[model samples]
Target: MKKSYCPIDTFINVVKGKRKATIILHLFQGDKRYNELAKLLPDISERMLTKQLKELEEDGIIDRKAYPEVPPRVEYSLTDLGKEIHPYLKGMFRGGILFEKRIDESL
Candidate 1:
């Protein structure tokens, strides 16, 4: 893979946007339908969600599959590369929880 000018920037580039990390974290469970993701991330606008999903897909972080039917069924799941990042994200989440607890105790 070609390296970005800055490695940290490259990481940020793929995981940029308000809900990108959350989206990835959610996909950690398993494949999810479009509506299911939307419901899970209710604060994000439809346009924003679509844009983020597209960007993640382009970055090779996630896979999007569409089924042919009366109403198209679409599902999103992490690609292999995406799954590699899951451990780091999970660690970060756990750290955040620990930090929050520390802060609460300090207060």
Candidate 2:
């Protein structure tokens, strides 16, 4: 398939999944274990969660660290690139809240 022509399309491609944005937002709070993430997004199915995490990791938006221990442990955190996008996400969030409020008032 052809690559995206627009910059926003490229960004959207990286975080296209339903849970991807929420995952990134949660990681903004702090690094989280696999189970922790699952807990944070209780509505997501395990299969879907695994898929989105893999996509994020492949896109270099998140880092996955596995610890060598009795019980395998995995943690996910944002990369430098991911951190760089935080301000943009925050801006989108504020705008979204205002947009929602406006819609509510209009209804």
The C-alpha RMSD of each candidate to the native structure, in angstroms, is 2.2, 1.9
Prediction 1 TM-score vs. true: 0.85
- The sequence of per-residue lDDT tens digits that candidate 2 reaches over residues 55-97 is 8898888999999987999999999988888888778779989
How does model 2 score by TM-score? Answer: 0.89
At residue 12, candidate 1 shows an lDDT of 70
Task: Output candidate 2 Cα RMSD.
Answer: 1.9
Weakest lDDT window of 10 consecutive positions for candidate 2:
1-10
Best by TM-score: 2
Report lDDT (CA) for all predictions.
0.91, 0.89
Give per-residue CA lDDT, model 1, range 1-107, as digits (tens). Answer: 23689987778777869799999999989999999999999999999999999989988999999999868999999999999999878877899899999999999
- TM-score versus the correct structure, for each prediction: 0.85, 0.89
User: Could you tally the backbone clashes for each prediction?
Assistant: 0, 0
Runs off by more than 4 Å, candidate 2? 1-3
